[model samples]
Target: MNQLPFFITIPLPDWLTERLAVPMHLHDDEARMRFVIELSRENIVCGTGGPFAAAVFRAADGMLVAAGVNSVLRLENAVLHAEVMALMFAQARLGSHTLRTGGGIHELVTSCEPCAMCLGATLWSGVARLVCGATREDAERAGFDEGPVFAASYAYLEQRSIAVVRGVLRAEAAAVLDHYRESGGVAYNG
Candidate 1:
């Protein structure tokens, strides 16, 4: 379990599929679009429907920067969950936790604003965290249930995101993200 370096895993919730479907992600455009497109393969193929688009301009203007996927997606559980996990693992491997907090104005490194699902994926993705706001403040913005979110989930007969963490503390991620950014760390945006 500890020796696995080729795989990264992040947890997912029952609603990730739907959440990912929404257009106009408020943060990094390229990363959000790639995540949504990859997760919506079935919907895209049918052509009957899908939220696919070349660009989703939600924040005045933005551009796609990075893209990637170094893991396999069985979709046995849910594509969104698998993708998030793999991405997270990749970030940690690249050492994205150098940006620290509490240094007289604590450089925020300007992390992208994560939408609800992105927030969930970002936090529980097994990557480090960044401090966006206060504990309760951020939680209110997440708009999801309480978390120290896990990698496995059960969603009736449909599908669900997987859990990837053991004893993940919610704020722990924020702290880590903070370091990742200020220390010149980077994320895949995919």
Candidate 2:
């Protein structure tokens, strides 16, 4: 028997790549919402990957630690969701595998509700909070195949002391998905 091996790579523009060098400070919830929406739009326009994107922030002051757009199609990796990418980048920037620090809380802000893999990543990311823009139904309505995420999934997060805020700037985020569908972007569900 033979075994096949695969690798993952995300090609980002110079500007996007430089985002890690500077600290992102989002003053309020509105700023964080705007950042996610813009990140989604940029992903679509720049042809990075999917229409979704995510950002990690310091829960204490809403300072953006890192941002990531989906790269599933670009990397040919099914688990490369926006939230996962953002968490990965955040960890890299902070030089820590976990986001939580001593007396400091981190937040995950995503353009849409997380699928199963991303949801699991969030739990393990060490972020103290999760804020989502669109819901699972919204993604399905846009023809993106999202993994099964039940209401209990959210309840479970809350049970674990992870604050969950859903449907932040939903229409704007959903509009990005609609645009992606209209633009005929590839919806690769692996």
Candidate 3:
């Protein structure tokens, strides 16, 4: 199979595909599950972190899988998370899951709470999973007209959702933007 280079090295689309179809979208369920774990490791405080902290995972074919976040991030630092979304998307693109390979593909995206504008980004990640952090009530309140809905957020704003996460080669996922001074090629594997 063909493998797309990592975001650092490859010329990824301006946006990832998180649409709804396969091969065209950006996320899926498997990736979403892993995203939950990734967010937890990032010290985002799943449920307690705030309302803004959330993760969105999709299939390689742009399918919505799972979304989780801490309500505090949403309530307090919406803009900060909003700005960091580009990072999250890049991470998701570079971060591949078992589902993202072969005839079957998968992808994921995660962020704290983001308003209407962010959704637009997920729509482009070319994945099947469409998941993010939102209060249970908020999810219910928002009511996705898309399809079968799942909750990645908390209801109490204090509750947390837990899921196992796994991924590919870890390069500078933690390092700050300045860390990549020379800018090595991406380690994308499928």
The predicted structure with the larger lDDT, 1 or 3, is 3
Give the poorly placed runs of model 1, Cα more than 4 Å off: 1-86, 89-93, 97-119, 124-190
* TM-scores of all candidate predictions against the true structure: 0.23, 0.90, 0.29
Which scores higher on lDDT, 1 or 2?
2
Give candidate 2's whole-model lDDT. Answer: 0.84
Candidate 2 has a TM-score of 0.90
Question: Model 2 misses residue 79 by how many Å?
Answer: 1.1
Worst 10 residues of 2 by lDDT: 7-16
Worst 10 residues of 1 by lDDT: 101-110
| Root mean square deviation (Cα) for candidate 1 | 16.7
User: Can you write out model 3's per-residue Cα lDDT over 1-190, one digit (the tens) per residue?
Assistant: 7697464322211212232123323344334434443443333322233223233333334444333333223344333332134334444545643233334433334422334444443444333443343322332233312222233322311232122232221212222111212233111111
Q: What's the residue-level lDDT of 49 in candidate 3? A: 34
Model 3, residue 49: distance off in Å is: 6.5
Model 3 worst lDDT run, 10 consecutive residues: 169-178
The digit string of per-residue lDDT tens for model 2 on 1-190 reads 6576685455554557765567668877667988888888987888778889899998887777888888887777787888988999888878888888634789999999998889999999898899999889888877877777889999989998899998898999889988988889887885
